[model samples]
Target: MSFKSIVRELKEMRDGIGSTSRRGGSGSRHWHSRTKSHIVPDVTLAPLEHVQQGQWANLPFDLLVDIIRRVEESETTWPARAVVVSCASVCKSWRAVTKEIVKTPEQCGRLTFPISLKQPGPRDSPFQCFIRRNRETSTYLLYFGLVPSENETDKLLLAAKKIRRATGTDFIISLVADDFSRSSNTYIGKLRSNFLGTKFTVYDSQPPHGAGMQLNSRSSRRFHSKQVSPRVPAGNYVVSTIAYELNVLRTRGPRRMQCTMNSIPISAIQEGGSAPTPTSFPQIIDKHFSPSPAAKGKGLISDLNHATLSEVPVQSEGSLEGLVLKNKAPRWHEQLQCWCLNFKGRVTVASVKNFQLVAAVDPSHNVSPAEQEKVILQFGKIGKDIFTMDYRYPLSAFQAFALCLSSFDTKPACE
Candidate 1:
């Protein structure tokens, strides 16, 4: 039989003697009345005796009925649940006492990982689609790696539809470089528009079957357009070069060293979008890649504790008036114990794949080739930060990630 069945049967056997002993021992005390020497009627106070065996079994009414009911709800439960509406099938005593154990609504695990598109049949891939489309359940993580085909795109859309219906708000969509079909020149822009309400993050890097794409000084890494275009079309969202590694699945081998720096978006391909000469994207960032000391706070609370204010309270509120501005605005985080703001800005460049970031204003440094090699090795050591990006992320996600990065070397001010 199955393991659960084994456990259930074992549980039932153990319950009989154990439960009986517990119940039988509850009133084991004895009391005695006055003796016959005084000439009054003599009485003996002793423990109450259990009923005789046949006397217990031959009871005509409800007392016997209750005894059976407790056994079913208890570990001795023989699920006398009816076969039909009324027939309990076998033993009459248990059948009379049967009832169901209750279950809570949210007790079941909601989502399963990795919905395969290749293996068809009642394998439940479409159920994932239904869950996303219908929004009937919530999933914390989703992984879709269907190779680019109309069928695959259709399946992906079906899943997206479900997420939209369920969330009643735009859901975040993340796709690897190989996820889309060879549909058309405008596919990326179209995908962004179709998912207009939802947040979109499209990665631009070669998959395992291809060679790694090298980045340039500008931070916008470009690929040969013999098939795939170098530029991803612009849309109403953020697009930039991020470190991409091959072997998204490879686990063994002296893991390949990979890095993609100096990134930019497709929209910034225009002349104005690109940075000025000599002020290359990487140069600007490398100038300011210095590690800052985590300091004590400078405000009154710091005074109350007699502590100094931290140099940059993890979150920087750029301006108090503009929460909606793509700029930083003041917001309070109680756990961080200070009022702060968050601001994210970008500088996009054309022609090159590794475009520089404009908003990362900091003290300049000459980034050496050795330093660059070290950053690439860091990606090899920690792959998650390289492959994933959170689009339109709230400050909390950034803060938590920063907290994690703090454990690493100091965190980079990446856009």
Candidate 2:
């Protein structure tokens, strides 16, 4: 059977089960409620419920696995790929089988779940994404699919709103565009820059690794509101740092920049080397299940309190570092009288923000010449308020988005 047909049958059978449960006595209704209570009431799983005697939920184990495996293989893109997610959400047994069948983005070269945003991109080529900017609100939206026309809409992977402060500037990123507040459950992470905007730090809402929550004294003083969920960590974990070289004199032809991905190791650039990829999401207090709006806000409010107003520290050149990215120099185009880097038609228009990134090799490490030539991430303008961002393995969408947002900031010293 076709994947959609099988999904339709599951839904139709669920309706029958619901009708059966509703017509039964109070005991049957009580049992149905208990079953739903155990399942996470998220967008993916809320539609289906379990029943001990339901024929749909009792499909043969081997057949059920095969069907879902086919669904995963058939539907490979978003909106359509959501069916695969639905198959997993059907029941506990289905979820287990589906999880086993699904592979990480690095392995499959496809984004299948929310956790994929935190995982590495495909190994061979960079995953392509685009950003839409709302100039009036100073917000940026990141989409997974190709660049859509003005009227067309694509899947919004992440959003960020720019906020200026007396000390520095902040870019508040979240899953939803409307609500940019740190007190919202959709809040993911943020980027903070010093007054000059030359240095920026990327913060993750959860730890990059499996490290236990260790709140520093600095963070304790910042978070005045004691109300916070125990499940949520106390402070945002520093993941990476981005820096722009001071170019006030305009001696350089183009802007020079560098980024140190603290969460990724330098060894990742070596052949057959792997970087740390988070397999699952952190324990987030689901806003949908919260008893009250006020209760949900408390847990979400603790994220941005610990940001440092001073300059984000730059890793010393002498110290052993994680993966370092340096901007590829653009040659002066004599014909156009403008700087240029071969974006291969991905970029158009001459904007100072246009640039490509390649891994910087350390003298101590033996790195391949081909690896150094590969463009790990590249960002440039395609239209007004629209841009393309392509990133490869060792860099997640979250990290790539944060890095692109840095280019949007006004760097007085690095113009």
lDDT values, one for every candidate: 0.20, 0.72
Residues 193-307 of candidate 1 have per-residue lDDT tens digits of 1222212222221111111223333323122122222222211112121221233344321211111112221112222232111111111112222111111010011111101
Cα misplacement distance, residue 301 of candidate 2 (Å): 12
Q: Which candidate has the highest TM-score of all?
A: 2
Taking the tens digit of each residue's C-alpha lDDT, what string does model 2 give over 1-415? 6756888876666556545755666655543443332221232233333443355477889999889888889888765676676676567677777878989999999887666788889979788889989999999999886675565536667889999999889998876666676654556689999999999999887666532333556554644444554334324667789999999999887889999987787777787677778776543432222322234333443333333222222232222467899999888889988887999888876788888999998667788988888999999999998899999988999999999999999987998
Q: What is model 2's C-alpha RMSD?
A: 6.9
Best by lDDT: 2
The stretch of ten residues in a row with the least summed lDDT in candidate 1 is: 30-39
TM-score of model 1 relative to the true fold?
0.16
lDDT of 2: 0.72
Clashes of each: 38, 0
In model 2, what is the error at residue 213, expressed in angstroms?
A: 8.5
